[model samples]
Target: MISLSKSIRWLFCLLLTLAAAFPAPAISAAAAEPLALGSSEFYYLAGHMEVLKDPSRSMDFKKALEAYGRGEFLPLPGTLNAGYGRNAYWIHFTLKRGVAFPEKSMLSLSPSYTNSVKVYVQRQGRSPLLPSSFSPVLLGSDVPVAERPVLNPNFVIPLDLQADEPVEVFVRVYSKGSISLTGQVATYGSLRNSTYYSIMIQFGYLGIAAVLCVMNLIFFFAIRDRLLLYLVLYVFTVLVNNLAVSGMSTLLFPNHAHLISDYMVYMGIGAQVLVFSEFSYHLFHDFAGLWLLRYIRFMSVVGVLTIISVSLGFYASVVPFALIGIIILITMLLLTSKKLLVSMPQSGIFITVAFGISMLGYFFQIFRLIGIIPLEPGWEINMVEPATLVHMVLISIALSERFRITERQLADASRLSEKRAVEIAEDMTGELRENKERLEVALAAEHLSAERQNQFLTMLSHEYRTPLAIIQGNLDILAINSENGGEEESQELQKMRRAVARLVDVMDVSLMQNRMLDLQVVGTSTIICADEFIRQQVDAVRWMWPERSFTLHSELVEESVFGEAPLLNTALFNILDNAQKYSPCDTAIEIRTWADGDFVMISVSNGIAGISIGDSESLFDKYRRGACSHDTSGAGVGLWLVRKIIEEHGGTVKMNSAAHGRISVGLAIPVERGETPYCQKK
Candidate 1:
């Protein structure tokens, strides 16, 4: 449970920290500057060239120039530039034969200032690129080439012809930036391929979401854990975020392109908030995050509609859309900041913190963009930013811990099984050795042993009583269950459990008396509603066997104490459980708690006998049931375990007796100053 809570806490911290502590976006991101375009008008030139079926007839430098020399720009058929980041998209363009050159026959030029371009001529794995400025490709006609482009950053030289032989050409646009592409590009032949490639890359994340969602569902079926519900929501949010950024929705869901692109940011943000919030709430029992979560849910509805309205209203104009986007974005952010995970369960708070760091990184990007800070482009804010990756890694850690806890549990069980196996094997081996030694002396008397076994069986009265008692209780349970069991049946069940408990007590006491092995008494932890347990224990002792009048009192009642509530209840119950056991039928028992100097004392005094100051020290010893009372039912181990437990909790156990035979038992557990009466119980 602790391990589970911790995983949930880290995830919460990460998510909460993001929503709460995210730094404000930098100024530049807040304010967009109008980019003034230069005086050059865009030149859109169109032309066509034939694709050559034969490689021998392929265009080299001479053929391209020969075509260019005729009139129009030489057409390189079937060339492609798919997208900004990926280089996989194939480009197919044809050039007239002899357009390919050994030195400077044909050149592919990209504008030097293009922010999003990387070009390469078809080559095998390696390509020499040119410098940043005026970099143009000069194809070598002498080399045997493959189908891909030679990756070159520089494409500066001009194309010229060696001869007029007509040839076909093909080139590829590996990637591109905002800068202009001039000099030459052939007529486009595969619009379908280019569009499909863009769409598929955009939808890649949808595939990712589908996989994660399916896995989450499978996990839900297997584990039946509510965390999987949030996981599914989380995966869904990532898919929506991916869709908006990658532009798949623009292609596949074109009718909702403008709407989807604009509103996806809001959906992505809100969905992520929901996933993280839900995860934390179910994980941590704390309700501090409740109201804030409610607020986010309420505002999210408004934010979504506003996005749809504004985006639809302002699609043609960048200003209205951008301004509306900012308003909704800020509002959305404000809503998430309140609850997050940190507000409720500290266990899940790390997830929030990680997200917070990532948010800070984003704010930095926004600041730079808005001109609040000066930061380099392409190097500073990006998807690969350190903060973002770290956040994802933290979340992964939380996921891994869940698996780790389960693994540890399995490993522990396996170790216990192995230990038991070893013990069993040793016991069997020892028994065999003992039988062999006995056989050496008793081989001839083995037949006489049968009669001895019968005599031993006849002497079993002492050994059979406890089992007979248990069977007696079991028979009572059978009779109760045979009828429609009401209070009577419940009493029978309680008797059975208590019978089993008493038998355990006897075994434990006998084991201690024999001292067969070294023993370490481990403690147990239990939940307590402190006030109620104390009141009930005191009241029950006061009322049961009412001739023993008992008083209940409290100076400071810790409402909730985590350690061994039931056992403590049983210990106090032992006090009460014993006050009833020892009190004079007509005398009184006093129960009170008050500040006794530095200690808070909970003492139970009953007018009874069989206890003295010395017995206080030794009466709690196992199997030391005193003869001062007719209570043969007392196994004498109850107070021993009680003494051990309370002393371990840093408290003392004391006993007192009067000449009148009145007795009292007092147990004090140190209540440290300002210690949480109820720190969360493990």
Candidate 2:
């Protein structure tokens, strides 16, 4: 009797299952019917839904249908999220005809990270309540690129609807990485268009990543900055990870699709986290404390572990470690901001705001994965992509700020150095001025002593001249009285008189030369005719030496000269006297004067015996005598005095010597501007 009861209960359960599977026609039809709209319409499935999980992945469509009939399937959750797992997730939805949408529609499952996806569609006319009634189609990253209905990186399934018919769809998704299944329904044409634009945006993401990577790399090389170097590594790893996740790498590297698998994607993520953590640690080194340092080290270890696990084909295990690293990075950033607030509040506030905005897209994605944020259908917004760009921009700004601060410090140091140099230069300049003034004072004292010596010599010469003149007078009386003595005694008296006269001449010439050497004691000045002056000197020399002849020549112009007339007469007399003394007593003394240029020139030539042309250089030096003047009875002051006086009057004197015993002394004095007639004719 218990066996019979068990049989009856089994039959009852079977009948109940059968009844649920095949409801009454009207009710079944109504249950299968989707919302009715116009022809060729497109819409998301908005009716009752069902979802199933296949942990074992052994269940077929028949069992899945049976599970749905038994109410084992739950209402459609926000998304089909399996997290990072190997389990397959199935989502089921029913759609009815909607407002006219041209052409057949398509279903898209985003994002493209899923390893494999299978889509099934059932029409109401084909036993829609049964899973066996559905036709299955496949699209996913694992599906061969050439076999896809739409050749796009993301999954797209085609859907065709008949008039007034309800349609149902089931999507199964599985992946070795994080499983995110967001389903979207739209016209096939619209989906293609969306796919085109999506590709363009993905390329944009790639372009931005590439450009920023290159830019930061340039800065890294230029500045040798540790932060910039790590930043470039982080950006490059992140870009590779994003490409793998987006499945674009599969299309780009079709020949090497196996090489760019989910393992590499996760590996890249680990590397990105590792580099980024290092960057953060270095950037905030000034403000970080012990705990923060330890936290960074811990994260770095985890990041390394994640990379090892992913590389060893343990991507599933590395997901959690990657998550832990992310959490630590975020914590470190927040704490760093707090520390910066105490030291640099303004910069801290700005950085905090920037980090907050940049982190939005990243956290939102995480929230969506954990079901903390609802999954959005249609084109999934990648908050992380734009957020990453913003973060990179913020990093650049921070680097620039650091450079600016450094430059300002260097500029300050440079200015201080320049100021010190200028101060030293000024001190040296003052010392040099003092030294120059002392040298000038010493020079003035020495010059004064020389003038005193010259004055004493002039006084001594005058005193000797008086005594010598008296001796000459005594000699004249002796000569007259000696006429009574023998010829020998008379000759001795003549010789003594000549000796006395020569001594007197030497003393006079020496005194005059000494006075002329003193620049402060110049001859008294007056207007004098140069031609008449020459004649007076010539006539005086003629009277002194009657044994010597003289020739006085003149070419007078309507020109005058201002000077000490007596001194000039003395200079001319000395020249003529020397001409007669040095030459044969019978040789003619030639004195000629003429106007040459702005001055009147005088030439005094005499026949000298053996003077060379080269001897003219030392002819005017003090105490210097011409080579042939040794036999002459006069001091060498004759030509030297003429030169000094003419030079003082802004004129010149030069000596010319020739062969054949011919020598000439030329003198020129500048003519005065005021016109005057010659007072004495030639």
Q: Please list the C-alpha lDDT of all candidates, in the order they appear.
A: 0.46, 0.68
State residue 130's C-alpha deviation in candidate 2, in Å.
6.8
Worst 10 residues of 2 by lDDT: 24-33
Which candidate gets the maximum TM-score versus the true structure? 2
Which residue pairs collide in model 2, if any? 40-101, 41-101, 526-563
The parts of candidate 1 lying over 4 Å away from their true place are: 1-210, 254-269, 283-357, 361-397, 410-682
Q: How far does residue 47 in candidate 2 sit from its true spot (Å)?
A: 7.0
* TM-scores for all predictions: 0.27, 0.54
lDDT of 2 at 131: 69
- Model 1, residue 251: C-alpha shift (Å): 2.7
**TM-score for predicted model 2 compared with the true structure:** 0.54
Model 1 Cα lDDT, one tens digit per residue, 346-456: 324555565566556655543333323322212321332345445544554454455566668789999999999999999999999999989876975865785575456
Q: Report how far residue 375 has shifted in candidate 1, in Å.
A: 12
